[model samples]
Target: MERPYWVSLTSGYDRNEVLTDLMRQYGDDVWNFAFFLTRRFDAADDICQEVFIMAFKGLYSFRGESSVKSWLLTIARNKSLNYLKSAFIRKVTLLDKVIPRERASPSAEAVMFDRLESAELWDHVMQLPRKLKEVIILDYHYGMAIKEIAAMLQLSEGTVKSRMFRAKQRMSELLKEEREYGI
Candidate 1:
């Protein structure tokens, strides 16, 4: 069977159809990258929305110099960084304290072992400096090649590898500390 018309980028697809397909293909990866950068759920949502808008508006200019996924992530990374620099974000500090961390039901804890371990690992990942954290997330979580991450972040391949090494070492130390303290 032939592929759907919208699925083939070579076809002269309408803007809306192309945009929709791009969103479906890249949305989760974009959102997760944004969330890692922003460290806040609401900001991730806003960044992801803005990314698609930018993608839609800039679609015609896309040169296909990289994969669409990489191009979309570059847009996402730029939007996320812009968000971090906004004055409104700088002045606001309410989300962390306002959001409750605990579950109402005890049943949640019953399944917590696996989830908690994963959560703790991510929490440590979050605590790393932004440079280190981004490397770790892109390299490990997103499974991108070091070369791709270097291009996406505009760093040298050696720099990306060095950052990844430091991130892993730091994470190991953090996990060891957690275990020693019985956290």
Candidate 2:
């Protein structure tokens, strides 16, 4: 009988084995979520690496309070937000040194977004108050269910749903303005 390739590849694996397997299985989806959130390939890569590092380090604390995917997503979201904040601070610090002008035009590949429009959509998303941005990113960008989002964000499901409704409505208006303005 043939052994499973994974069995041969690693030895004495425990529950941590499940994490490695899940990473292999859902890596692309997770990275895509990070990419949409960060709007930069390099930032997504960094966030994904950090997520895995965290998952590995914190594996011993797993309490099964939430699904692994949800837990991982919460980590990813926090990391991405931190990165954005750090980047924003750096930009602010350097604002005087850099020319204040429009950002460089997008590369041809950057113009192609699988969802909504360009990464500029995230600019509008960032413009939203934190509560709205959190809900929108969890529901729309991460494809999390309202119940899951409520659990993750510690809000009631009804609140999650309502916030999601308002987020989509506001996002619709923002997107329309973006299109009209060609931004």
Summed backbone clashes in each candidate are: 0, 0
Assess every candidate by TM-score. 0.82, 0.64
- Candidate 1 local lDDT, 1-183, one digit each (tens): 112443335435578887887788788889888988887667888899999999888766776666677788888899989899988886563554676456466442234435665877888998999899999988777778999999999999999999999999999999999889977
Kindly give the stretch of ten consecutive residues in candidate 1 with the minimal lDDT sum. Answer: 1-10
| Model 2 pairs whose backbones collide | none
Q: What is the TM-score (0 to 1) of candidate 1?
A: 0.82
Model 1, position 23: C-alpha lDDT score: 82
True-structure lDDT of candidate 1: 0.80
107-132, model 2: which lDDT tens digit per residue? 43355453546567777887786678
lDDT of 1 at 14: 75
lDDT of 1 at 111: 49
User: lDDT of each structure?
Assistant: 0.80, 0.72
